[model samples]
Target: MTLFVDMDEVIADTYGAHIKRVNERYNMNLTKEACRGGEVWQQLPDHREAIWRHYFEPGFFRELDPIAGSQEVLRELSEKYEVYIASAAMQFPDSLKEKHEWLDEYFPFIHWSKRILCGDKHILRGDVLIDDRSHNLEHFVGRSLIFTSPHNVNTTAFERVNSWEEVCSKLL
Candidate 1:
């Protein structure tokens, strides 16, 4: 089975970092607690790219933290499937590289042959696609693990889960 994984909010808390950076750089009173379900960008309309640039411009993915239990879950999943890092992060190439490097650092157990990077994850054609974006799920062709996003509630799905731990259970 080919398991397509998304970077950002699914494995790492990129959205959280974005929020913190926005508050720090723009002196906004926004909190990471408020940027949920598509509200992340809404909270910082003035300094959007500034926050993104802070993390992905020079490539900050190398220092990012995987979501709690993310490494363990991916490690286990890798044992049973072909794990592919298929992300739609082309809008930020440097950030994408950083994310891939972080995954390689944390989940080295996965073979290089199993890793697949792409801009549109729907093209990967995996048995399962795990992503936080609702539109991505609509584009995918198989079973999907729709990770919860504070900013995407307007989009709906039948298989949405609130956390990676819950996804681990459902997938296993």
Candidate 2:
């Protein structure tokens, strides 16, 4: 099976990183639970532009912590499927290189050739796609699993997996 996995909120803890920075900068107590069904910036209207700018900053993607259990679960998944890392890297041009480096550091076994750092995911043809964005899953012809993120908490368009363990239970 060809399994395509998204890098950001799915395997990388980008949401948590944003929330952490926002909390530290503004001295507010913001939890993932508090931001459910909305983007972190949406929760902080005044600082929304500042929060969105985090993506444009250098090394932002490279410095993000990987979601817990992703390494182990992806390693196991790779053995059973033609696992490819599919990231929407073009939204932020700097992210392409940073994301490449991040993947090399955290997921070297996946290989450079298997990574698809692209503009649009609709071009991909695969058996299964695991992503945090519902729009990406919307165009997928195969099985689409929405990896839960705070912004997508209320999205019921696709099957959702809250953790790598849930992913393992379904796809592993």
Candidate 3:
């Protein structure tokens, strides 16, 4: 079975990266709990533009830390199922290239052919989709697993997995 995985908050800790960038830039300490139930940018209402700019900044995507256990879990899952890194990368100018490079450095096992960087995820056809954004999983025809993130802590419209370990218990 083909398993489609999202890059940003699902496999990569983009949510944490956003919060870290804003906190470091503004000289404030913002915790993940502070941004629960919504996007990190929402936590910094006065600095929304700064938070948004991070996505456009060069090296932002490349500098993000991977979600814990994603590399090992994905590498092992690849041995059992057809896995793909499906990210909506066209939202930012530098993201497409940076995301590709980031995946190469971090998840080299996911071949170039298995990477799908696009504007819309509605085109994806697979047996399972694991993503952080509820909107991305809304239209998926197959099983949708909402990978948990601080921003999506309140999401309850679909199946959810709080960690890669939870994913292993469910999918592996």
Candidate 4:
């Protein structure tokens, strides 16, 4: 089986840093407790790019701390399936490179043969797509898991999970 995984919210807590910056800049009482599964983006979809650019522009990929148990789950999954990364990050090539480098450094067991960066998941078909994005779930026909995010709501054909451990349970 070949598993295609999303990068940002699936493996890394992409909004953790963003939330901190938002609080600092706005002086609002934005607690991490306020981070629901789909409200963040709903609140400010228009500012998504700008927020990412400001908070995640430099060394963001390199600074990506793996979600707890993510590395272990990927390592275990790699033993059985060909795990490939297909992030939605089509614009920032440098950030994409950083993601690859970081993955290689942390999960050295993952072979280069299975790694890939694609703008569209439909173009790179996989047996399973573990992504946080709802639109990408539409393309995956077989098994699919939607990693829960602060911005993913109206999605079907994808089981939602809050953590990598949950994903491991579903996939394994």
Candidate 5:
């Protein structure tokens, strides 16, 4: 089976990175639990722009750490399925390169040939799609697995997997 996996919240800890930067820059205490069921900008309405700005930063994607168990699980998955790292990276030009490098460092098993950097998810064609945003999964013709992120906790429109272990159990 061909599996398309999202990078930001599914494999990389972009949500945590955003929260950390926002908390540091705004001098506020914002935890993942507090921002559950919503985006970081939504939780910090006052610092919405500031939080959004983090995504456009030079090293934002470069400095992000991998989500727990993502490397191992993705490696295991890659052994069994044709896995592709599909990310919506056109919005931020810098992120395109940074995300590619990040994936190379963390998920080296997924070759450059399997990496797809696009602006929209609608063009993706695969047997299974694992992403955090419902919008990406909404129009997907394949089975959609919503990888839980703090921002999408309230979303229940698709099959959900809170952790990589859950993903392994469901797909592996």
Candidate 6:
């Protein structure tokens, strides 16, 4: 099967990184639970632009930690299926290079040829798409697996998996 996986939130800990950076920069103690059911910027309405600025900052994508168990599960899945990292990277100019470096450090098994750094997901053709955003999966003509994020906990539009372990149980 051709499995196209999203980078942010799904495999990369972008939510956690944003929270951590925002807390340190703004001197606010915001937990993941506090930002549940919405984006981090939504939680910090006053610092919305500041929070969004974090993504555009240098090394933002490079410094993100991997979602727990994602590496192992993805490596296993790569052995069984044709895996690809499909990320909306064009929005951020630095993300293209930083994401590539991040993947090399964490998921080196996923080669450059398999990485789909595109602006829109509608152009992708795959058997399955695993992403955190419902919009990305909206036009996807495949099995949509919604990888859980703090912001998307309340979403019920598609099949949801809270952890990489749950993903393994379903896909592997």
Better of 4 and 5 by TM-score: 5
User: All candidates' TM-scores?
Assistant: 0.86, 0.97, 0.97, 0.84, 0.97, 0.98
Cα-lDDT of candidate 3: 0.90
Tens-place lDDT digits, model 5, residues 50-106: 778888989999999999999999999999999999999998998999998988888
In order, candidate lDDTs are 0.73, 0.92, 0.90, 0.74, 0.91, 0.93
In candidate 6, the residue pairs with backbone N, CA or C atoms under 3 Å apart (3 or more residues apart, or in different chains) clash, namely none
Candidate 5 structure lDDT: 0.91
In candidate 1, the residue pairs with backbone N, CA or C atoms under 3 Å apart (3 or more residues apart, or in different chains) clash, namely 36-150, 36-151, 37-149, 37-150, 37-151, 37-152, 38-150, 38-151, 38-152
lDDT for 71 (candidate 2) = 95
| Model 4 Cα lDDT, one tens digit per residue, 45-131 | 776676767534778777877777889999899888888877777677777778788878876786677677777777776688888
Question: Which residue pairs collide in model 4, if any?
Answer: none
Better of 1 and 6 by TM-score: 6
Tens-place lDDT per residue, model 6, 34-122, is 88899999977998888888989999999999999999999999999999999999999888999999999999999999998998898
* Model 1 misplacement above 4 A: none
- Name the candidate, 4 or 6, with the larger TM-score value: 6
TM-score for candidate 3: 0.97
Residue ranges of candidate 6 with Cα displaced over 4 Å: none
Residue 23's lDDT within candidate 4 is 66
Total backbone clashes of candidate 2, pairs 3 or more residues apart or in separate chains: 0
Best by TM-score: 6
Model 5 misplacement above 4 A: none
Candidate 6: Cα lDDT at 48: 89
- Report the alpha-carbon TM-score of model 4 versus the true structure: 0.84
lDDT of 1 at 151: 68
Q: What is the Cα-based TM-score of model 5? A: 0.97
